[model samples]
Target: MGISKKTIRLYASAKAVITQYLYLPGSHRLNNVIKRIDKLGNSEVESGIEKVMRAFAGRHRNIEQTFLNHFSRIADQNKSSLEYFSLQKKILLGAFFTKEYSIEAAALFNPSIVPHPDQQGLKADEQRFIMSLRATGEGHISSIVFQTGIIDNMANITLDNSTGYFTPLKKRLDTSYNKLFISKRAATIPEFNRSILDNLPESFSAAEASHILNSIKPTEPSIIDSVMVFEKIMDNNYELESSSHVPLNEKVIFPISNAESMGMEDARFVKFHDGEQYCYYGTYTAYNGKHIQTHLIETTNFDVFKIRALYGAAVADKGMALFPEKVNGKYAMISRQGGEKINIMFSENLYFWKDFQILMEPRYPWEFLQVGNCGSPIKTTKGWLLLTHGVGAMRTYVISAILLDLHDPTRIVGRLDKPLIEADENEREGYVPNVVYTCGFMLHGNHLIIPYAVSDSATAFATIGLDEILRDMKL
Candidate 1:
């Protein structure tokens, strides 16, 4: 996933190589050799001179006095040798400890911290994918590369100096198999723009920002495979503006159906000029009344796809399976994709990884294989409610709802708090485990028809009044 080498030579310089050496068994002996060299530099010559002086001294008593006075300058030499040995020992110790610390610190990738099988499938969230690791406790996400293909490209390179030739990691786009994947527009994402120049000073000019932004690849790859655009039709709580099919237009429909008892409420919808008439299912909650339980609304993906791509309702692969387009229409379900149920408001199938090999990512915590379809949905005002489900990796599932624009659903016109109900802990821990899924839903008056699959095997459901959901899914 990086650049090539030869072009690196043509680009610029590489980071300097710093030698990080380890202390070996013979290091102490090496220290001894240095000690001998010190002796040769300071002691041998002085000793030889002292021998000559003693020989030259005349009588035995004079010789004794001369020996005492000369002393072979041994005092100074002895002190220097001791200091040298102390310094040398310190140096050797420093090297040994430094290497030892590095060895210990580098063990983070050892199997204990990361325990997952090697598999390829998307997780709950739709980004930063994880790949199957070389099990045996290595890590969850690690890969090796063997193929390289690219034409001319400029990149930073390293040099040997003597030869000005550059070596580069000329990483390039997938200009292979007739693919020239590229994004021509400058990145508009504030964080991305910020990340590009994050280290730059405030004085940096827009030109500099432009340079950094354009230097790297601009488009991030899309991971999920379906999309839907919901168009709402309500102006407020009235039906006056909803007859139109345009979503997020300058116009809006009114939420004409009002439930006065709910202290506060939220309802959202999506109505596009091109959309066919569709039903809206909401997950509702009632705060002031005794109807404390919450519920989900059911709707179809065909309406979702009318205005957007098929996979707009995305999850972090682990939370929800990709709404497969291969199945299309009714088949694009969370649990019962393409199947029919005798009842419109109950559930029978809950979805899961099934076998870790079904998707394009690995299962990990950050990428914990499954999460819920929590993004509020696109709906018409009457159909303008957003519904979401929350799933614990092993213990619980809650369904929540809110209301969006009758046409422009992003307005997030409404939201719900206090999830209606959470699944039972005992019911949530099987192999395929405690789960809740809603791919299809509908609305009939104040009732939200939600058929959900639980824990991977059986499907069941409960009901919440429309007024309950309208107030809770706020913001």
Candidate 2:
């Protein structure tokens, strides 16, 4: 049996544009460029400052303040005393070193839906949702952006208009690491010395770890490897904050950690409950041009986030999604460690996972190449309804559904033999052709609300009856 696609009309939005600031790199070449601007005549400098502000002031919030911040960082080494007006001029000159980056200029796709934290203003049968999307910009660098919307009982979707201003978190919050976990991760590197971790407290800060690394003298040939590992560990664990004044849609979670300098791709967000309060957690892939790592993001109110690298053998690949709640009193996750088969993993700690059991494989011809979970499994009365993506001939990607035993999610109960959603004629054109992918989906009443990407270029929504999907599945 196959899932019947609904006939609802779909639309894409062009108004959800987020702007990011691209700062100039600190280098000898750039140093000379700034020096030449500093030597310009007063009249020239004033004229340049006015021109720059007139063009960019309307595009950003507090543009002058941002320029001043950048100037202070770049000119801190200057020993020359200057007047307030001169400093302002210098700040304006530094503004030339910055450019506004439209984060979603290239593509906006791979969306995940979660229930909004505050849902007080909605009508009956109307539920508020917070959708996280992968906003790809120049160079295909993806950052996490958001859209707030509502889904009515009839399965109609409406996305809120974007704030037009994008603000990356300016400051990182200091985070502490578990001494045991750090030591264990260090042992994985062949060049690392376990003794370096000795005598440290159970929990330590980044500075404390760096200080310990500095005390060691490296005479081994793998010294570079050891240093790289240390830096990677420090870079992967950090915190970020956005201003409260910024709208949720305006705030962007850009790549801050060195491990994810390339991009943060496909965030699968789930509203997790720990028997008391609900917290949102996302498992996303972090790419650094050459290598990929899995990272975990946690936030209670979506304003502040704590992103850290996932550790252990099972956290090695992309498409790792956590169960919305604990199973059998342990944290559960769905992962694809071998790149083809879906595996279920349980962990005592959220950041670390070492054990896994094979749950599903490519059983149908439509998924002969590979299969992965679309998002966290949605729990239903019948079972755990899991939306999955499958790759077939010509590298086409399609969405399908399966049911897993609620108590033991590893046991498959029912599955759809035919594709549920595939790339249509109009949707087959984009950055990457013939692909329909989604990091997550949400269930509203009797409808399955799917916000998916078309050929990796733009995002659109679809809806299907949950009962119809279940009835068509084969056990």
Alpha-carbon RMSD, each predicted model: 28.8, 3.0
For residues 159-267, could you state the per-residue lDDT of candidate 2 as single tens digits? Answer: 7886667777654635777767666667656667555555466777777767766776777746546666766887887888645678888888888888788899999
Global CA lDDT of candidate 2, please?
A: 0.81
The prediction achieving the highest TM-score against the true structure is: 2
Give candidate 2 regions above 4 Å deviation. Answer: 1-28, 76-85, 171-173, 176-181, 184-191, 198-228
Clashes of each: 110, 0
TM-scores for all predictions: 0.25, 0.90
Predicted candidate 1 versus true structure: per-residue lDDT over 401-449, tens digit per residue: 5453443322446545445545466446432455544433333344444
For each candidate, what is the lDDT? 0.27, 0.81
